[model samples]
Target: MNDSEDGRVQQLCSHDEEHLITSGTRYSIKGFRFEPPYVLKRAAGHLCRGHVPVVLQLFFLTLSAVLLLAVLIKGQAGMADGETPFLVTVSSIANTQGQEQAKKEKVYKEMSQLKPQINHLCRPCRWDWTLFQGNCYYFSKFQQNWHDSVTACREVGAQLVVIKSDEEQSFLQQMSKEKGYAWMGLSDLKHENMWHWLDGSHLLFSFMKYWNKGEPNNAGEEDCAEFRDDGWNDAPCAVEKYWICKKSAMSCTKN
Candidate 1:
């Protein structure tokens, strides 16, 4: 064969060694020759020698790295999913407790407005106190004898409720429905069947008397009058019942 053929310079190993340089062989500048290995020569018909093993090793390493990364990501995601419910539950509980506290504070604030002050006109009435017709009215939560009720009203700079008009009467009637029977300012204790108001006004007109049917019969020495949903009833002065208190709206300091 020619010394140079098919882009390969055939060269003899120094001092007559047996190996022959064939096509696709490389040589160093110092005259050392390199030839493709048998495996690469068979696989690719004379490509570079030892590159196949390196390429396969790199591919496997890259594949292994990708798999490891995917496993780590999946594990982290699963851990997060497992813990999310507890975190969400705690957050919801905190929000609910905060809301309940806020509602209670709001209710207390509203109730505080009912507290009585020294002297102010048109000021808002305390909790459970209602305003009507330039007057603030309080419906007692507890029962007391008529005389005690009158005393209680006086302590608050008020008087037992005195109805001057039909509207006032209806208001008391409705209020007393929920609060039970309430003592009014009316009594016939001084004179039998002759009703008078706490302000010492005579019950002059028959139209102003909203007596329940067959009331004022004066049974059992009944003298004090109380009102219910129906109307007024003459009860004993010693009988205990809820009472209403009325104060002038001008009693509170005006803003």
Candidate 2:
């Protein structure tokens, strides 16, 4: 308890306190300051343990939202620029193809409708001509002499009708029933008493020589043959009478 002892003990205590405060200290450099290594380490440990994972999750979520927004904006801009989307373009092309196919089918159907129908059971003949079996006949409406009648038929690319059967004879007999007389293809003008067709062809069948009772008597120098409702008869070549013309079925096919 002397005064010197007391003062020395007090100075030692003060020095020890100052040394403790200054030891491991941080210093300010210009406008920046640094923490001691131990303090910085404690702060980093708190951030890693408590808040770093939450901050990372928030950053990722924000980035994902920004990316989605950008995609939506691009799609809208493409639509506004009049650019067709992939699905829309495909649909439009398909529609155009369908229309073209429909047009082609319609044209084909029209052509089919317009085409002529031909079959074995039925045949066509020219207008104003009658079809029977395999031949077509044109019954004239005006009267002409035998030679002039043959010329008239030849002018139309046909020949004077030749009666080949009793059926044809009956048909002709019925056709000129109203007029009562029609010049036939039979003629003896080339050689008297020898009957022949307009083209100088002889009659092939003996049964075809049907005559009315006692006719072809060569009366009045009758050289041409004409028919009435009953049967054939010889007459003058200059006597005018309605005639008949004939053509094959093949020649009338265009009808």
Candidate 3:
């Protein structure tokens, strides 16, 4: 509105709940002079005379809305720019780092589950076919004729317990637990005294080889092999002692 009209409204608005007389008619500002009936009349007059306070308020509100919208858009752009580095690091952890971390956790969980059983079976020598810690190991305590032992292990889901390395040999030596002789995968019955292991280690030092001297003594009848607590020996293949048998853990039917 022009300064005069704005001045009139401003004055009328003061000392709320007081009376105002403009056109020889009395009016009181209970809450505002801009109540509906009066507001409608004044609005119509202002439209005719181009003096509307509500219209001014509408313009100010529109300006404030535009400013608020601009501020919101700028703030969103700023946040997106700063978020790039954080997104990169989160990908590094989730895609690459998270995979490695998951694998490590799985290994640790398996090891924790297996530790006690492995310690029981493999601390000395690990048997490849039996469940020890979280895996499997094998140990046989019965004695059989050489051929019979081989067949027995196979029949129940095992083969000759193959020794892998010097480390393994030493371990088995320790686990032989009995001070007696234990048969291994070595034989020369076809060549009589000229022996070789299945894995092709020549019958080297029968020194610790537990031989009963007059043993394997080329006795054309000795097709069998035996050993003693003292050393290795030869006997008939028909004899049976506490021979070792092994199989997969699942195959262990012994109750």
Clashes found in each candidate (C-alpha, N, C closer than 3 A): 7, 0, 18
- Per-residue lDDT of model 3, residues 135-214, tens digit only: 23345565666787777767766655554445544544554545345555556766766766555666656343455666
Q: lDDT, candidate 3, residue 123?
A: 28
lDDT of 2 at 83: 48
Q: In model 3, where is the ten-residue run with the lowest total lDDT?
A: 15-24
Residue 13, model 2: lDDT of 36
Q: What is the lDDT of residue 116 in candidate 2?
A: 58
Mind giving the per-residue lDDT tens digits that candidate 1 earns over 56-164? Answer: 5345435544654565566566665655668889999999999999999999987778555433434557666799987789999899999999999999999998887
What is candidate 3's TM-score against the reference?
Answer: 0.34
RMSD of 1: 15.9
Candidate 2 wrongly placed segments (more than 4 Å): 1-123, 251-255
Best candidate according to TM-score: 1
Over 4 Å off, model 3: 1-143, 162-174, 177-181, 199-201, 205-215, 218-220, 245-255
TM-score of each model, paired residue for residue: 0.51, 0.50, 0.34
> Against the true structure, candidate 3 has what lDDT?
0.51
